[model samples]
Target: MPDTPGDAHQSLRDLVYVQLRERIIEGEYPAGRRLVERELAETMNVSRVPVREAMQRLEQEGFLTVQARRGAVVAEFGPAEAEHFFAVRESLEALAAQLAAQHATPAGLKSLERILTRTRKAAEAGRLRETVSLNADFHRAIVELSGNPLLQDMMAPLDGRLRRLFRLTSGPESTSPMCTEHEQLLAAIRSRDPQAAADLARRHVAGTRAFALSALGS
Candidate 1:
């Protein structure tokens, strides 16, 4: 069957959703910044219909909040929200690390090692953004290595929020410490020590939570 207008717009909607989500997560569209449908449509050379659909999807994902006056504004993370996020994150991360230790194969371990190698290089090069992105990749990789489809499914939705949180806490001073913690966690997984891996994961999340809360003045 020939593609209809709806089919075309669906593809455009996904593209717009991805682009807007990336911008929001990267802090280009800071919290409280209103996103105008018409403006974005014009900028991206797309129709308002697709832009609107993309915004609605982002809103469902907690990256944007729509209001009567504000239309769509980037979501903010306050103390309460931060606490709730960290609570869930710590649990999931600990579980992922433990499972990864139990299930990781030699190939899976090597994949994580590659991510760590790139992360270390990025940190050493003083590439803050790349380092932060690699940090998120490392965590996601560990989750994948858990070998449980259910656990992977659970972590999927939080990818964007996790990246945002990482961006918030990342800095020149953070790169080294983050690299060290990741290295230790990976080593635990390599050693097939589920308890050690889980403990390291919990501590890692706890450390990031404290830093995020302190920076947020929470």
Candidate 2:
């Protein structure tokens, strides 16, 4: 059902949203870049209505800042915002690792393995965008394995921002270390070592934060 044709009918606004968001996150539309509805509409070969809707949604999601006459510009997060985001990630991801270690079933572990395998392959193939998405999914799989609905909901929004940050800084070397850490973290979870898993998760998040902050010039 999820892959059905009915489910594939993404609206023009949704399509515009995805393209614009990707551009912003990838720095194709860098910080403070003005988002002109007419220009975007013409470039995307779409109507202004969808581009306007996409801009509104992106503004609400902190990817764009709308002004009275200046229209919308790409949003920029300063050091404080970066620090706050990383702190939130550190705590919640640690909790996720702990819960996953304590609650992961055989099937869940298998799913995590699948995600990790795909992630490694994407990284090795030089698919940075795919690797970023898979990296988020890999983390999401572990968080979902925690068997906590609230925790899953809490992580959903954060994953997008995490992807943007990860894509900005993570290169080939970063991918290898990240994959190695994920492998060791999965091993800890499989062994049911809650403390080890949680510690490793926190460390991973901290490392990402450090890289993100440095890359942002914060």
Candidate 3:
């Protein structure tokens, strides 16, 4: 086992990757912003090697574009790609929700209920970022409750992209609508209605997709 939690080597890479990724998602880097390796190395207080490695990894992960002489730049979202990603995510998340509804334990449902309460409060308090994070946590907990490791693996990458998109679309007014959708999703899952749960999950992602598309001017 790795000394550090959550895949040590990958965690190191992810630490750098997440900071850079969040910067891009938060619009600090913006689209087509040039990434300077040495500058980032200095700012992050790490060697250029890790920065370069992180940049290459991010590029492979679709958050950046690597140019021969120009180095790396933040990747721009094209409308078609965004739509396609969301469509696939909707299908996968709906399946996950259905499985969760079928398999959720009493304890799992209770935990989900608690998460919903916290998420609702976060949204009400206008903590958009925290609400977005809790939203991901709520969905991840459902996926874990499904007891399907393969399904969890399939959803992880898409979840990362969704987080980025959420950050992109985040505003004061965005939280309430999302909170309402989450409430509906939890209601279906708590009822143990797989079809309803699946439908609600799909609708939630679809709504987010529409919101992100509009925000991206797609």
Which scores higher on TM-score, 2 or 3? 3
Predicted structure 1: clash tally: 0
Off by over 4 Å in 2: 1-10, 124-127
Top candidate when judged by lDDT against the true structure:
1
For model 1, what is the alpha-carbon lDDT of residue 14? 88
Return the clash pairs for model 2, or none. Answer: none
Per-residue accuracy of model 2 over 162-195 as CA lDDT, tens digit each: 7777766677777878899899999999999999
Query: Which should have the higher lDDT, number 1 or number 3?
Result: 1
In order, candidate lDDTs are 0.91, 0.87, 0.83
Model 1, position 167, has a per-residue lDDT of 85
Number of colliding residue pairs in each model = 0, 0, 0
Rank the models by lDDT, top first. Answer: 1, 2, 3
lDDT of 3: 0.83
Pitting candidate 2 against candidate 3, the one with the higher lDDT is 2
- State how far residue 192 of model 3 sits from its true place (Å): 1.5
The TM-scores, one per candidate, come to 0.93, 0.83, 0.87
lDDT of 3 by residue, 1-218 (tens): 56775476666666888899778767789878899999998998877776787888788778889778877898877566689888888888899899998999999999999998999998898888888888878888989888799999887766666667777766777788887888888888888899999999998888888877888783
Superposed on all Cα atoms, model 2 deviates from the true structure by an RMSD in Å of 3.5
For model 1, name the residue pairs that clash: none
